[model samples]
Target: MKKKLLASLITAMMSPVIYAQPLPPVEVIGTPDEINQQRLSKETVQSNVSATSDVVEILTESPSVSVNQAGSISGFPVIRGLADVRLDVQLNGMPLLSSCPNHMNTPLSYVSPSQVDSIEVYPSITPVSVGGDSIGGSILVKSDKPFFAPTAEQVTQGEIGAYYRSNGNAKGGNVEVTTANDKISLTYKGNMAQSENMDAASDFKTFTTTTNASSGTYFTSGTEGTTTDKDEIAGTAYESINHSLGIAYKGDDSLFQATFSKQSAPYEQYPNQRMDMTDNDSNKLNLSFDKSMNWGKFNIQAYAEQVDHEMAFMDYKTSKQMPMDTESETKGLKASALIPLSASSELTVGTEIQLFKLDDYWVASPAPLPHMMQPNTFWNINNGTRDRYALFAEWEKELNPQWKTRLGARYEMVNMDADDVHGYNLDYFPTSGSGGAGNQTTDAVAFNNAKHAKTDHNLNLTALANYKDSDTFDIEMGLARQVRSPDLYERYTWSTWPMAAIMNNVVGDGNGYVGDINLNPETAYTVSANFDWHAANQKDWGLQVMPYFTHIEDYIDAVVERDFNDDFKVLRYANQSARIYGVDIAANRKLAENNYGDWSMKAKVNYARGTNLETDDNLYNVMPLNATITLMQAINRWSNAVELILVKEKDEVSEVRNEVKTPAYSLVNVRTSYSWNKLRIDLGVDNLFNHAYDLPTGGAYTGEGNTMSINGIPLMAVPGAGRSVYLGFNMKF
Candidate 1:
């Protein structure tokens, strides 16, 4: 299978060269010429910014990057099949941590697409300068920088944009205002978005009622029986608002900036998880200074963030509402300097210190509640702290005019600990024991008695060489050794009770998970090679084929700790070995230019496979083979495009977790935009054929029914949106 896929990728890359024509160059954001990274083109970002509010969704435009569907705006960006905390995702130089156990408020969720000025992705063999405490990849999201007038006089400029989509009646808008002179600048940005539950093209479930014989049924909305419409996909509605303010000072050879941002999400329903986000509020402050010294460049940054998150079942799920709350505070400082060793070489050295504190506790149910949750607050994780200190250095040298090399090393010390924890109503289920109910007390006691603190010293190294064979061809190869310590929830979630274990699921797999403090940090050894073929001018056509492999030691996987009637087993996090390999093909060409417009085409294909060496089980949530092709037309002030997306059936399922398999599918979309002197209008249609399909990585559906019961509801894949027509307009002044 791997050989066949490789052959197909080679064929795709060569096809574009046959009909290539002169075109403009593709822009690389924030990346040097020697860096091996995938960048989103400005045109692509502008075209899709109005279609979706999800910031991570824009990552799909790059090769080997996918999204794990969750809430409307909180999709997890999957890089080379690795999702969530496994990847290093930074927003405006700050690494934000998700506070919720379910990862309901991901790092990227805080930023709207309207605020993005650039996105850069460094896959598999990432450089240590940009990667640390991550085994997979790195994503950098940067907003527009402070702008100043050419002269001393002050200048004011900004943008206002709004968009509406037919599906789920999604509507949103954004506003940006800035005032600047040659010496100082001030800016503000705000965004608001809301949507109703989206519908699928066809019914994907057999039963309308959310009930079964195993779990007792209950009345919903004052009715004896509740039914969901066949075409309606419940628990997909969402609403959110964000605001940010910035001020900057520019002086000769130096700059200083400060930014503050806040986010409020009243509700964000998730179809793949048992609980939805009832409320999430986050605030952040960032300060930075940049100076040009005699040696090179120097920069220092400090950032702080706080998150207050609450989760409960939405109206769609007629289950007992158990409120889960999480509060986290994060602070970090980073300093870096670049020095020129010689005319052909430069070195970068940096250090970072980060401290994270979290409190994940559940408010006890008051009187009249039947569950065992009453009487005492449940301390899932009290006074949890994860601190990391890191130092890194990278050296880049121009070996010759046609060859460049880079080497980097990073060392990180991670310390993690949490206070003792306990379940609710300890008196009801005494430590003496009762059977299923008594397990909670026993588990709590064991966890409380066990060691609660852990520290790990990790090291990472990366080496790369880029050989420019000619103006039209070049190849970049690299080797990397990366390391990542477990996150707070991955090592501290102690409860074995199904209810509590299930709430800690970050993958939305509808299964319970118990953490193990003994699990070792994951270390990955990776090798990657990229072959590039482009027009001599670097503008007519381009094709890049990259293949990579990674072997992970002490990979954090799960083993069945307990099973309830052989359904939805409670799994414990364990250290295991794993392997992952993949190939990515990307190409672009200028077909022709005529009175109709300048015709061009761009395409990307990604394939990945992962396996657990210990159990020989397929790794969970690995995305299936997928590809995207887009044809674009550009003339004067109007831009238009037609896109096609394809995905293969996901048959390599994870037997341990009973991961759902989705069928093969394809989709078509069309977009058109026109720009005038100060105004631009965009119109687009997604899923034009209204095809019915499930997201390959959407995970199992547990949105409704008796979600508290491990197996009360049938498992199914979350369906994709059917169709939507969107219109957007932006005015600049």
Candidate 2:
């Protein structure tokens, strides 16, 4: 999605005095040629963020991005062609440490969308200062920064707002009270939100196409079945409670802040997912401090977060499952510094470490095992941990006033370990549903000893050249080398899908499953060029176009066995060559701003194609051609904006059989806002036409051809949220 406004101040961005603080080596923020996403002129996360009206709504405007889900409220965000854990997620500059055993806790779940101050995404060419074992991209979700009181005004502040939705009787409210002085600052904020999603829409495409031979389900247009928004099960998702508090301090030379948050769900269910959870209690805490100096600045941060996810997963076939489970304890630490040696050169160095572990206590009561199968006798446990560390540095040199260059590199290493893995027996159970949660039978077989450990060496580099003129246009071009390490799940998590896709019948059995300890990282070589144009004091029109291409030498992926009739075949992680190419164009302009209501329009178009060199086919999940257009008329306090979005159906396939192709569709939305003094209200209409459709899931698994899943395995589709409304109120005092 293209934003309607650009960095319009060509003179301000190009002026020799870009910084008023005497040039103590300012972090590059105002340079339009630097690829900065916002106009904050500071490195503070708040300045780079784009406050998304809603989480899913955010992806509609982003290029080369998509989302998928089995329900309306929760889904996975796909960046580039990678989804799930392949993307790097940061909260307050620290990692959240993902441990989603069943992909239950998506990255977005770590923070509430309404509470986000900014969300800056760095596509394929991620900055080493943030990206880790990420393949698709990196996203930083920053909490709102403290709103300082004007030096000439009182040191008091407050804000309050409420939002309501139609479909699920959704309602949320927020209030903030703050006070700040010359040296100290503080803000306390709270919110209450809940939603009943029995009104969500169902995906029709999934109902018509299937690989099942025994079941005959047809497709018909209109409200043929249930037109309700959500699925048949009302409890698939439950109401939630959210609360948070924060404290901060700032002086002429130093800054410090801390935040505490809590979120809970009373009950949750998903027909598509075998396991159900009664509760997910999460507690999060973040703290960081930065010191500014004359020649350079140094930053440091420490964080700790824990999630006690208690869930009960069930197996339909055997009438057995894991109930009341717990996955607890995740922690980490990080620190960085920047130093300037001369008038035109600066150096940045940083390091980070994190450890994530899981403890699953499962018990099964299979109905077929015996007559009076004990309720909890069968017990099994799985304990695993992953440790990661990295060292990085980036340097910038000003070859001349109108030219500059940047170079960066990083070295990283990661290791994983698992114990007591032989806790279940599969000889008597062929599915995750057959035995209790403790009955993952494949574990008792001849397990690979090296599955518990892995080692990886990752490196990165970036070089750029820029041109700028106070009265003319500016452009920037760069070549970067970024590599993502294999996630722990891609390595040690054994037979991870049988429990999730057995009923589908098209899934592979873990009969011959072992991880490749010698797998290499997915490395990419990317080249990009972006240009920005401004018309001085004219109508203020700007356009930016960036085209990039990436080539991967050893892309790690799980390939299927060609000839295997055992239902499921040998599954191993292997390396392959892949190439991706795409172009992104976005423009914003004030068409005719004479006096007939300042007219402006914005548009963005992006397309990408990837191929697996080894298979001679399209990459598994490349994003299709997509675009968003918005037109608006502005008059003082009232401005109306209308948007039309188009997403071409993607039918490309690089995998075998070429069976999985998503359909095409379009969406429209309208937004209007009014402002008065320190108060403002905005309203928006999403999917104004209420169109129903299917979006690509940017993920692929081995199956028996394109016939769909044989056993009706519950696969989630990124269904578009149909016909919705949003109202936002902002107040400052």
Candidate 3:
């Protein structure tokens, strides 16, 4: 299907002969307004494509945002030090969920950076109409808008681009075509990418090991003993293809658009998880409508998405190959309207409904295990379903020339259910005396009789105010209460055995987990503020500072479930109180300029701290204080920049999991771009200094085919990518 779509796009581009006018110059990249929500323009997306193709990587350029990478191509976006279910990530207003148990196929993984037109980030305080059941914030990614001819004439426009990187021998290409007439427009886009295993810096350490052999360590070795490669990171290769088609109709007062997209990732290896994604395929269909009315503007959207995912071990370290298959389907609809109440006030109201279904199971494999008494198909989660209905209303009032305020509220009801599940033994495995092998006990009756239906009611509220003290200074303060229901896997997974529990972990902790049927929803109360300072002219310099705090009533956490053996432990999802606080500071200034070029300097610093209030323990996978500085120079149509990134050593680690501490490191990168008429070229060298480092939140190191110990500490953290040069080009016709 991918090949066919690519061929069709190529054929259409070749047959096009109607020459309209030359395409307009690409938009220039600039910093977003400090007082308003941040946005990443199309030019910024194009500039970063040389470094990475993933949309999540591009988002990291924004202040207070970071990425947790599991492989070269798979990464999860962390906003304000929050990740996973905390943030609402949407593509063109459509929400996407990960189908993999380990979250290898995140929402952002579905859209390539080349296909994005813009990205809007609502940091800390989000409007109720955007989404429900989130605490961190919201990220909305918009693809290129449909084009319609202004006059009563038909026109065609398109672009073809390709890129290559030397680090992983990576190569990819993208194609976009659009045909528009007076009343209708048709658009198609296709992208394909593939890469081999990525290499680390020459001096990078692969693993940590102990000198003494007498002490038996559980965390220092792999489940199945393996060796590691120091120069190349194992299980960091991937290949993917995606295609999207859109059709739109435009009128004087109303417009309608429909889009269909298909994505297929043949495989993506995860060095942080025990298994790798062998097959991942997804399909999305969305329809949206907008109309102008006397009272206001009305909008409506409906979408459906389906995903089929599979995972397995492709190496020889494990005697048994555990292959898992999972499938998810999501359908949703949202409608909203903006109505003007007064000249200084506007009211917005919206409602949303979503239904999700999931199935998780493992097929019997050929490999045999001596620890198990017998083998059978494991029903991890059977017919799991989650349904949500929400309603929201927001009012924005410009109380006076100096003060503006926004008030919003939302109510949501969630229903979750699943069928009875069973483990391979169809029974509870006891650690002590038992009828099963290895002194294990099995109780099939208990698991099969467990209840699976649950429901939750969640309500959220927001109150925000902006005060303008002067032309050059402004302050914004926001207070919000948000709620999030437990995911299906956290509420419905019924297995307690090691293998069954480990398959449900989303965090790359290399540990097994079980779900609790009676867990309560998480409710968070937050307070945030942003201060902006700039020159009166607004072009020479600017400064912005943001501070935020959040307290969660029933945050989901893991509790160790003891078994008979001392080498292995199982974790069960539980509720606990937690708190997180952070601050972000950024500054940009036009330093100097000459006849030959102009120069500017920009710097940003971010810090976050989280803790389990009840246990007084540090939160897991929290990124430490980091800072970035950049010097940019531009001359005519060419732009060049150099960046220095610094990270502080992580000393506050998770006590529950005994998380490893990452050493401090600094890196340098350089990038340049040039454009001429219809062609554009981008060149970049990442990690210019060839520094060896690891991401504090990169998750556990599960790299196989290597020894898993460095000194005394377990080498369980994924290493950052090594130095690499990339080159790319694009031509529009």
Candidate 4:
């Protein structure tokens, strides 16, 4: 499909050199903004493509939500007012389950922009088929179906394309090949690169020549400076590795996809207590299928993934080794169906089941034996897992031309089990820790004694109403009740590592611990409404605007509290109330008539603000108001484009003190492409202007009061990359 799109983009670039005309405003397809509105395709509620991309560069740059990417490792997407599972993510109709204790992966880690067909972000609840777990609403993501790549017709057979982007020594490439016939077709696409990121500006009193001022922990950027150890706050530059490959198959009745990826990076992150997450390796395998027939359109998918991570950062004023090594895996399946009864009605139903697992194979060699439970010795190992299943359905009907109503319900079940399989309990080993080594004590390869399990049930009900095509505006409203259970981390594991604490890597505290056994699933009451306006449309010009809101009950998240030991700390999962709301507005204009190689301009601005409602605290990682403008030029076999992007500052923060303060900024980027026969080439400069910035603080445990390393190095402000560029090429036979 990317091949087809590239081809079409090429044809649009070539074919008669007529200047490109601006396109009409596009309606969102999946967002559940107002009551009874049917938003699909050109109308998918307000889709948020950012859900499947990296936080630093994904789509949600609203004014209300603030998002900060922690180095290249993990990303936190601050929604209108929620984070974690409170904001559900549905990928290709299936949930992209996030099962990490630290939320290393959110919905954003899955696919890139090229693989997306639409993004549906219901900043507010609007339907039941989309689920009811959202206190911060939801995002429904769809990938391009395996269809022949599209290209303007000169009459066609196939097409090919390539592109390059770079800044400094930084560079990358993208290539796509596609072909299709009336019955069978396929699209193959991939991107690969090696580049250096720019150092991040510091969080001190000065950042750049034109920096900002800080009062307490609050930072307002306007007049910026580059001072303090501010420069030290920058993430490593030139640390690199990124690549991905995908294939889509299309038949008269179905679509199938297979994909794989590998990525790596070395850098320090911000708002974190530890120094780094390095020697990191990640592997992913995914497969999915979709089919439509007389009965209905159905979809199902299965995927497995692993992250081989290593990090030797400063903690407790000491250096805990890297790859203290931890690995995580997820395997699961999901299926859904949509059946049409009449032109005015449809019924949608689906079920999904998946198993999530985690294992921490400590890299400490000499592996532990039965009698070696001495204080600092390598003792045991552990493996943990969680399983989940959900069934849901919804029915919709048009009561009249201007009014639509719908009803839906869902049921979910969960089961979890975890234990420390191999570890000795010599004189000092806790049952939860890896066991001992040598003499008189017991020794084992995989101990299976310490274990635990739990089962859960949840149900949700929904109602929706939409009033469409009324004057020049539209409205949609919806309400839903949803329940969710605690995952693996929320239930098992409670071992301390000499590796926790910023100044105590050599000291001691349980680094990766688990919460108590008695915990309740989170439940929410989500109500949402949307108001949309097509304020204007003239020859080659159009405008669109939308806004919405949502509320949640018993929100689930980990909180900090003193532990049994007077000098220690541990995290526990608890239920809290939360409410979130936000809005999106966009517009487009034809730069010229479709004649003379059509040329045009496009731009969008979005914003969202979320609150815990209970404490009225900001959810971690929410995005802030943002806007983008791009100039597109369409010509004969040749075309190019340029863009300007802007993101504002974020102030709302979680209750945790010393919380990182984020600053706002802007950027510039450009791209161009050319086509000859079935071959094409292109180039792009992301962060074209190369602005330096830091994401929201990603928390790393710091013992009571310390931030220095074993080498006496004060923790640096971990920020993402600065400027980057890429160069890529490709062709079809």
Candidate 5:
């Protein structure tokens, strides 16, 4: 089917040129305000395309950005000390949601690194115009845009790339093609990647089989057969493919564009969580129109998305595989206008509306003798819906030659509701007791009897100022008030049973979670400052330091609901006060320039801490102090670089969740790339020392064994990958 679709697209090109010259790169023009935010360099983005499949990894080079490792393709982005739903993440200016309960399919997972054209991060002091329904900062990602020929003559251009990695024997390839005239263009992109289970730098487990030690029972690992080796990370393997088609039209004063995309993944294993993703398929359509008016600029955008997701025991967790399925739909529309109020000032206003619906259910397990195995279907989240409507306005003014200021405000109305839910049975299988079945029935009764509808009126405000102190120094400060409403799962999940609760966890912690309908929206007040020091020429050396603090009211935190006296526990979401503070430093300098090449050095450091003010317990999954430094040499069309990564020991942890602690560690990596007129080749080696270390934010490892039982697995943090050598090549026509 994939091949047939690509062939059809190619045939529809109307016999265009097959190997025409590559078109000149497009130049982006933005307002001066855009320069205030930090952006990733194009070189840096292109260089890492062959090293990782996750687009979120590219943002780690920016200050105050971290990743909560999950599946290879679905790493959660963390800003400051918060992650997941707390951050407002956008792809191609559209906000997307993870349809799965475990978040196996994230927004970034849909777009490959090779498709990214530009990325920007607003670590803390986010502008109100760009922030909505989120307390943390914002991340913006844009895909490569369609290109049109400069002349009336038709033009055809494309690029094909392939890569291979030694670790896990990973391999993938990508292809992109564009055909265009002066006024219209059509483009297509497709990519697929797959890998075997990766191994840790050293053996971390004692046993090879995942069979339950206490019960002396074993099950096959999916259809693949057998158990994992001592050094293998059982559930780290994955396979995925993505395809997109775009069309664009340019008029004298207006432009219209549309994109259709699809994604399919047979499996994406998650070692940190108990369950693995068996299938995830999605389809999306996006449309936009932009016009240049005499008074201002006007734009409108509309998008729709649908996802079908399934989860079950895969890889090593093979005992009594339970099938869970989810279906979600999203639709959104936005319109904005930028008007110049004066020569030195501009007014920007926009309004947006989004509607989402979801349904999650689990089928009855195969007839079995196990006490917990049921004979009926389970309703997890039936007919769930969340809708948001928002309006925002911002004003930017050049107060004077040396200072500029911006003020903005936004209002959002969020409504959420879900139908009743129930478990597979009302009583224990063999005997009637106060166990899993009884608790499930009781929780279902209570949830059904109570109201499931909720509404929140949220407001956000921002005030910012920038001062150009001198030719070599400048400073910027800002204050912001942000608000975020809970997601459907946080407000509608209706079960306390350990097994059911564990399935709803999105943080990858080896724990179960229950939701509360009474939970309140989070409101935060933040203050931040940035100091920039640079050489007079702004090329030889540069340094940027940012510090920020936030106080949050009604923060969504968990409280122990059921303690099993073990590593895993069941918790209920509740509203509480919390605080977070962090600092980020980034610097770069020209080390030397000789016949060898122009040498340069760059470094980034980040440190953040979060505390539950009510209980004084540390926040879960807060990254430890870390830094990355790189040395680069460039000569002609050849580029080479070496990187060092350092991380501190994690001692502060969430007492309620029994979060694991990791020891300090460091690693080295090297890469070199050479380019010809129309082709490029890259070679790189990661974890050059093959060092053994635990990932501070990797959560608990439950890749295999009796994952169904809450306490069946041992307590341990996931280990980092071993050394890997990769080779890649790309050709353009």
Candidate 6:
């Protein structure tokens, strides 16, 4: 199977060369950085931004990136089939931690697409200059910088934009104002957005309750259900607002900047989980300094952020509301310097320290008979902390005119600790030992008496070589060894029951999960290569092919424990060996130009597979093979495009978790934009054909108030959004 896939990839890469024709103008989406860095294009960023946009939406345009969506707004990016803590995501060069135990409020959820200037991506292999605590990949989101006037005279500049969409009745607006001079600059930005429940296609399938005597006639039985079409997706409404202020000072040889931001989200519902976000707020402050000297360049930065989050069961689901509160605080410092070693060589050295603290607890509400377990507050995690310190060095040199190489290394130390935690005892429930409030059990007592303190030491190394064989072709090869320590939630969640155990899950799998304190850090060794082919001018046509393989030691895997009952199995986090391999292909060509406009075509294909060597089972939630094609036309100030997306059926699923299979589907969309004077207008229709389909990586279905079985087996995935028309307007001063 692997050989056949490789052969098909090679055939696809060479097809474009054999059918060469008159090329059209090509828009470069990535700018080459030192060794393994790539910058997103302005056109690509603008095309994907909208009122209800997140960073994951824009990142999915890249060849090697995909997204796992649990709701309309809860989307997480997956790099080479790795996500969550395995990947490092930074906003304006600072790390942001999610306060929700379920990770409904991810780091990227805080930044709106309009506020982002550009994004730098490192796929599979990362540099030492960036932080070295992740094993998957790295993403850096940069905001618009303060502008300085050419002369001493002060200048004022700003922009305002608004957009509306029909699917969810979504509407939002953003505004920014800046006044600057050569010596000083000041800027302020604000945005607000709101949306209702999203509508799915007519044929979207969802599990509904039906009568069946053969399955023992139980409401929670998974074998007594059938699939049916649903129109509106439940528990998917959201509202958010954000504000930021910036100030900068520029001297002859030095520059200093400070920024402060605040975000408030009143509510965001998650359709793929049992709970919804009721309230979330965050505050951030950052300070940075840069100076130029005769020896080299120097940079210093410090940042801090705090988040407060609350979650509760939706009103339609249950009469009693169970509330969960969580808090997270993070502080970081980074300093780096570049020194010239020779005419063709430069060295970079840096150090970074990050401290994270978390507090999680829950309050149970009064309920009627059978379900009335406890009304006291439970301590999920008390004073949990994780600290990381790292030092790194990198060297980049031009060996000759056509050959270049980069070597880097990093050393990291991780320290984790937490106070004793407590939860509701099994004896407090009706099904267990005794139906009492204060009764204690062996499992709860053992967890409370357990000691939780651990430390890990890790080292990362990278080597990359690039050969500029000719003006139109380049070859790049890289090898990397990366390491990542277990997160606090994966090591300190102190519950073995269904309710408490399932609440700590971040993958939206709708299954209960318990943490194991003995998990070891994961280490990954990867080798990758990239081949780029372009026109002689490198502006008319282009094609890029990347292939990679990774082997991981002590990889995190979930084990099923069926000791509790037959209705559900408890999943415990454990360590094992795993392997992942994939290939990415992209091609673009400017076909021709006529009286109507200039025409062009672009296509992208992505494939990935992962397996655990210990259990010989497929990895959970792996994305299937997918492809996209776009046809574009450009006039003087107007541009139009149509897109076709295709996804293959996914059958290689995880047997341990009883993962579901998604059928193949295709979709079509059209969009157009026009700019006049200082204003621009955009109009588009998504899902033009109104095809009903389910996302392969959408996770399990947990729709509220729906007549679906609540059993945690034979998983039912959430359906994708239906047809929608949108209009947007933007103006500049």
Off-target runs (Cα >4 Å) in candidate 3 are 1-36, 203-228, 316-320, 367-374, 426-444, 563-568, 705-715
Compute the lDDT of residue 718 as modeled in candidate 2: 33
Write model 4 residue lDDT over 124-208, tens digit each, in one string. Answer: 4536566544445566666555555444322123223333323324343444555665444545555433333234433432423
lDDT of each: 0.84, 0.56, 0.77, 0.50, 0.84, 0.77
lDDT of 6 by residue, 1-733 (tens): 9999989755643343322223224565444445666567655676565534667888877877889885455588888899878888899999666777789888888887777888877888888788788888888888887799887598999989989989889888889899999889999988887887677887454444442433322222111233222566655678889899999999899899999999999888776777778888999999999999899999999999999999874442333456789998999999999999999999999999999999998765555412423545666777899999999999999999788999999999999988765554332322223222323243445555666788999999999888889989888888999999998888887666665666777887777677777889999999988898888776679898989999999999899854444434568899999999999887889888665567798888999999999999999888899999999976656667899999999898887766668999999989887666777788899899888888788777665432122364344777788898889887889
Model 1: colliding residue pairs: none
Residue 418, model 6, lDDT: 82
lDDT accuracy of residue 646 in candidate 6: 94
Worst 10 residues of 5 by lDDT: 23-32
**Candidate 6, residue 221: how far the Cα is off, in Å:** 22
Candidate 3 local Cα displacement, residue 622, angstroms = 1.0
For every model shown, the clashing-pair count is: 0, 19, 16, 121, 0, 1
Q: What's the CA RMSD of model 5 in angstroms?
A: 7.2
lDDT comparing candidate 1 with the true structure: 0.84
Q: For candidate 4, what is the TM-score?
A: 0.70
Write the residue-wise lDDT of candidate 5 on 1-733 in tens digits.
Answer: 9999989644533343332333212111111355347777565677788898888888887877899999988999999998888988888878898888898888888988888888888776568777588888888888876798997689999999999988888999999999999899999999999888888899999977644323434222333445578888877888999999999999999899999999999998888988889899999999999999999999999999999999987742434557899999999998999999999999999999999999998877764424444767677888999999999999999989788999999999999998877778742222223335638667777787788899899999988888889988878888989999999889888788888888899998889999899899999999988888877766678888889999999999999999999999999999999999989888888877665556788888999999999999999999999999988876656667899999999999998989999999999999988777889899999999999999999999988777777898898998999999999988999
lDDT of 3 by residue, 1-733 (tens): 9999989745533443332333222221223232236777888788887678788888877787887776566687787878877888888998777776787788888889889999988787678978878888888899988899878899999999999999889999999999999799999999999987787887455443322222322122222344445666767878999999999999899999999999999888787776778789999999999999999999999999999998875443343456789999999999999999999999999999999999988865543443352465666777889999999999988999999888999999999998765455534332333344321234233444556688899999988888989988888888999998998778776656565565677877666677788999989898988888977766678788989999989999877874533323567889999999999887878877665456788888889999999889898888899999988876656678899999999889886765678999999999987677788899999999778888799876665522222122244567788899999999999
Candidate 6 ranges beyond 4 A from true positions: 1-25, 203-229, 316-319, 367-373, 425-440, 563-568, 705-714
What lDDT score is found at residue 557 in candidate 6? 88
Backbone clashes in model 5, listed as residue pairs: none
